[model samples]
Target chain A: MTVPSPIELVCPAGSLPALKTAIDHGADCVYLGFKDATNARNFTGLNFDPAQMREGIAYAHARKRKVLLALNTYPQTGNWASWTQAVDRAADFGLDAIILADPGLMAYAAKTHPQLRLHLSVQGSATSYEAINWYHERFGVQRAVLPRVLSMAQVESVIANTPVEIEIFGFGGLCVMVEGRCALSAYATGESPNCNGACSPGKHVRWEDTPRGMETRLNGILIDRFADGERAGYPTLCKGRFEVNDETYYALEEPTSLNTLELLPELARIGIRAIKIEGRQRSPAYVAQVTKVWRAALDKLKAGGAEGFSVLPGWMAELNKVSEGQSHTLGAYYRPWK
Target chain B: MKLALGPLLYYWPHQSVLDFYADMAEAPVDSVYLGETVCSRRHELRLEDWLEVGKVLADAGKEVVMSTQGLIESESDLKVLRRIVRQRAGGDAGFRVEANDMGAVRLLAEAGVKDWVAGPTLNVFNPSTLQLMIDAGATRWAVAPEMAGAALAEVRAALPAPLETEVFAYGRLPLAHSARCFTARHFNLQKDTCEFRCLSIMDGIALRTREGAPFLTLNGVQTQSARVHNLLGDLPAVRGQAEVLRISPQGAHTRQIVELFRATLDGSRSPADALAASREWMVEEPCNGFWHGRAGVEQYVAA
Candidate 1:
């Protein structure tokens, strides 16, 4: 039997407990961010402080697992020092890799801490192999997490052309738009992933229970409304219902999570170097559950190859419970035709 | 500040495309950006056709620029990008090209073609990214549309070199783009067989919220704000930071809008009068909140 490639299972860790949980549950690496706007998941009560980061890194290292620091947001002019300082902290903490989006930050990291590995964040919006190769050539970017905007065929084509390692989002909240390239959030809320590292930032969100129904608004703009028994997903602008051509519908995309469990065999066959879970704001319990399922799935795939791999019912059941909007989609991966 | 006509975001008829530039050649504009920067499947005008229009604009003493596609996905897309870069490298086009994506930047930099405009899609938020683009031979950059005026002033001040700064002064704010064609999805058609429906609609199809509030516009893969983003009222403030103010082409009255901006900038027309006159030419309500560092949908009027 042909041997299956070892696809790395990268999990999310918003806190030290999450990091330890991910590693203990068999994650090859756990990615987290600083507790500030320097990282994309800059939500309150989430992420790690410097002391927590040090402890998390030590724990993962002791367990023979890797820890990645995500300093993914683009810095504004005056606050440029904060991003650079975050990079410095990553190097000081001896992170396995620093996931970044800003080219300026990349240049600084390359020059100041040459030894630190750089992984281009999805927020960089490098959708093509040419762009990835260019980053590799310029700043020595070792890996790139692709934005969820490519089909399976396109992803395979990109892998064939670039030498940099490719990591893709395998599970979690889905961004219908091309990351870093979208400004929908900024249009409605005056903050975005590129500037403030948050989309539909919680500070601006208001959920009100009224006689009409349960309504959620972002910056005073109505995002979505749900009836008594209907489930209301996160008020991401893209997933909200809107009117088009005199009909109201989810004009962009519905609230859903990306689940590539069924595509594991194909993903492994295509030589994806890593599979990243999308929520760094989720709880430690979530990290534990997802890490276990993915680890089990990867282990089975590695031992049995593509022919014997199958997504078990129990795994799907567990994944469905944690899924956003209580539903999962293949997202851009399974597009039969663009 | 110079008045620039941004690349036509909407697909028009072949003759209309040529005629529009011909009319623009005489309009009060310093530069005209040509080529299809949006969907590659848009076939109304090819590179040769764009070159023809660019030559006309060039003959009219207008600085012509060939803009590349924003989202590069397929091999064919890359091939087209290479052709555009090659034109610049050969110096046969006699016009500069705008690098919308990093792939284009890599091609232009590698081809040793210096002095390209870094399109707004490049996401240059701070001085560091802007500095890197300059090192890669970028001589000018269009600030991202959502950038506030305060942030623009700060970034421009911190620039290592004196690169020309352009701002999206007027247009329907392009909020997002996806691999999935939103227009196709709207028509319930597959993306591969989209039937070029966008050509029939001059501007994008407007999408509104259930409360009848205009929210977005669907143009193939791009999702734009339903409201037009206007910066005419902020021209006095914009002049402090930006060297060029770009006016994106709309379905109608583009020349009039250009004249209004020129007249206002030249002190022949007051800013308030120009703002009011320009509103008569717009397709939707005006918003400048993004320029003022607020929600892009809000129209912020300074006291």
Candidate 2:
């Protein structure tokens, strides 16, 4: 029997507790961001300060676990200084790699710190092998995170064609639109992942209870309204219910979580170097629980061959408890044509 | 400043697209971007058909450039890109290609085709990235529509030299792209069998709030702003910042809109007069908030 490649489980860490919890639960790597707009998950209370980053790095390094800093947001003309400073700190703190999306920042990192390892963030939207290869050639990127839009066949083709290491989203909240290119939030709220490091930013979000229904609006444009006794989700424009052709529906995507448990064996077979879980804004309990389940699943797949591998119901149950809209899907990885 | 007809965002019927190009050939625009930049499934006009249209536009003294799709997801899509890049080789049809994605960038670089335009979606916000793309063979860049006027001025100032910059001046702004087709989902159909529903909705499916407020628009896999982004009033602000002003095609009054912009640029008509004349051609209320450093959909009236 052919040996299955050992896939790295990259987890998210929004806080010190989350980082520690992820490490304790068998995450091979944990990615966090600096408490600034340089990273995409630049929420108010989330992320690490310099002291926290140093401590987190020491803790993970002691346990032989890796730490990757996500410097993923696209910086405007005046904002490049802070992003490059974040890269400087990442290298200074002895972090394993920096996940970046901006080409200018990539060039800066490659030129400033040649020894610093770089991974292309999903926000770069490098959907094809050629795109990934260009990043690899341009900046010597060690790995590239695949956007959650490609089918398994497409992923396989990319892995077969490129020399760059491949990483993919294995679990957590899904972005319906292409990450870097999406401007829906900015069009409505004037804040976006590109310019402001936030989508559907909290300052623009409003929730109201009315006789008609529970209404969620972003920047005065009603995003979704739920009937009595209905569950409500965050009013991201793509996931919100809108009237189209005189009918109301989630015109882009229904709120759902991407769970790649079934594709673990296949991804491993295709030589995906890492699988990242997508919630840096989540709680520590979420980090620990999700990491434990994925760890167990990965262990089982490694122990057994593809013929013997199967998605454990118990793991799926644990993951479903934290799923968005309380629903889970294989997402775009398993195309219907296959 | 020059006028450029941006790549058609909507998927039109085969003859309708041909007719639109035929009319564009006579417009006062300096350049025309030809190709399906939005959807790969929009095969109403194949590559050969676009080349044929390019020949006609070239004959009419319009500089024609082929644009690649913004979002490429399949092998077939890559094949079409290769054909487009390769077709530029054998003949004197030496037309520039605009790359919206890095995949197209790599292919163009591999083909040794320099002097390409980096489409707005490539995300060059700072001078460093713009410089890198310049090194990677980009001769021009369409400034991101969401860029604040002040920030764009900063980028222009910091640029190593005066690179040709294009401003998106008209049409419903393309807000986002998705793996799932919003228009298809509206009809409860899978993307693979989307039934070409987007073709019928010329201006795109208007997405409104339950309370009857126009919020957004759905165009197959692409999401757009409901309000047509009109920068006719802000022409003075972007005059020196951009060398060209781009007008995305709408179904009606596009040629007339081009003439008004040309007149405004030539100082024959004032910005206020041009704004008033072009208001009739716009499908929705005009918004120039991005130039005024506000929400893209918000209208910030200049004093």
Candidate 3:
């Protein structure tokens, strides 16, 4: 019997520099989206243009790294032309695959570009093996990016049942609810993660100085109020603190980064085909460091037991130096924190 | 356009629910979609009781469409879905089913049923997805609540001929659903052992932000906008695209809402008067932003 190589490290890059950095740092694949609502990271100063996407794909492919284009946002009813055009352009760019969430887009892609390898986006929120199998049977989806809401046991169960390749989020900002299904953002800012690729967009975010301390708000809803000397986290909707009964608490999720760096060996043992890093809006240097560390850790795990190699220390330290406030969580991978 | 009383997303008292629909029988709404769309734990109306309500509405000259649960968590949920798709009134044939989740779609499709309503929770954002549902058995589709009117026009343009499009014109917009029930969690109850506490709040309990602004409403596992979406004014603009307009049932003044929408559609009431009339019916503020591709909270006025 022969042991297969460990799961590939699929990373994210919001810009050309980040893509190059990730590719140089041993990323097996890199995923990014266009600079529009067609992709999920429809932020102010992130994502690629047509020329940049073409060049970025070439840059990654030259380094023997696959480039997956994220055409993940659900097409707005009348403006599906832009989404359709995005898919056509992605195929024309010789991209490795297009990660899709919408069933209509999947049907269109399957019909128009039958040869283009399709990976189901996590935004599809396909939790069960039956749902995954539905996409596989219907659209011939090559891989399915498992939503971050699932547990490792669920992942194992899904892997056991589905023939499609499985990709799990390894690091970055964690969503408490299933992706593309959540409307908490829309509840506040009128923009939603499902429709607009952004959750708690920076344009709506504000850090205000109050008599209490520093109050962080998104779309005028105060998420957190920090004391004078206390650290204030980014005002994301899910990470916000709210009063349920009389006690104030984090209603959605605690403000934390999802770091499963220590669970690499365990994940690899479970037949996960790919491990993905979730931040597409991070700096190039941040991408390089995380990718390099994970690459080294994965290589070490392949050699033997992952003894004396814990990504926790380096990952925590490096990420802290970049952006850290109070703590980090393993998200649904470990426990469902209240 | 025909009027569809969307699924009862809230948990009213069993008697109040019975009374509400009984009153709806006299209302101008053409169709009534009964059963639970929020959580299965909400047992104000069981399958038999929903069918019973359907009988009264049917006798009153209203079409009855039994809706399936949106978040099908367990095998019991699947069983409920199966019953909705299979159970027929008076042993004639199954009632028209509205498939909310993909499981419902799969169940109905496998049963060889060819006419169903694709519930808004199906997230049919484009024409291709709409066509897929139509091919699978859907004769009509309720556009996702968050979809803008412009986007809807595009979807309508690409839709296969004869498939009716229903827009969520009124009611508290269902924002999202999860396995974890916020209402149950509010009482510090685990989801599995939830004491059916969701029934206490006739409408969902409103969740306010730290600044004391209305943020959202929690109904079992489903989260909805605190602001009820009133698109009566914009109805004229997109009226051509929609063959049916859905008015979701609220706890209070639901019959009045039905009348207002009906009058507006019938040209008896102007959009401005209907908009003003809506204020008297809603428990919270109204928004029409998602219809304009703006924030869901912004009530955009047509220029």
Interface RMSD of each: 1.3, 2.0, 2.6
Model 2, C-alpha of B300: deviation from truth (Å): 1.0
**Higher-scoring candidate on TM-score, 2 or 3:** 2
Q: After superposition, how far is residue A335 of candidate 1 from its true place, in Å?
A: 1.7
Stretch of 10 with least lDDT, candidate 1 chain A? A329-338
- What is the DockQ for all candidates, taken in turn? 0.75, 0.70, 0.38
| Range of the 10 consecutive residues with the lowest summed lDDT in candidate 3 chain A | A319-328
lDDT of 3 at B222: 80
Q: If scored against the real structure, what TM-score would every candidate get?
A: 0.98, 0.98, 0.88
Which model scores highest in DockQ? 1
- Candidates 1 and 2: which is better by lDDT? 1
Displacement of the residue B240 alpha carbon in candidate 3, Å: 3.0
Which residue pairs of candidate 2 clash? none
> Candidate 3 — which residues are off by over 4 angstroms?
A1-5, A210-212, A217-224, A243-247, A261-270, A300-326, A333-338, B12-16, B40-60, B72-83, B86-92, B193-195
The positional error of residue B145 in candidate 1, measured at the CA in angstroms, is 1.0
Can you write out model 1's per-residue Cα lDDT over B86-164, one digit (the tens) per residue?
Answer: 9889866567989998999999999998889999999898988898899898999988998889998898888766789
Candidate 3 whole-model C-alpha lDDT, 0 to 1 = 0.81
- Compose the digit string of candidate 1's lDDT tens values, residues A150-259: 88888999999999999999999899999999999899998888888899999999998988788888898888888899887778889999889898888888888899
For residues B1-303, what per-residue lDDT tens digits would candidate 2 score against the true structure? 889999989888998998889899999999999998888888999988998999899999988889988888888989888888887644555678898999988888888777889898998899999998888788999888888889989998998798999989988998888777777778777778888888957788888888878888888888889898988888888897899899999978999999999999899999889999888888888887777778899988866
* RMSD of model 1 against the true structure: 1.5
Better of 1 and 3 by lDDT: 1
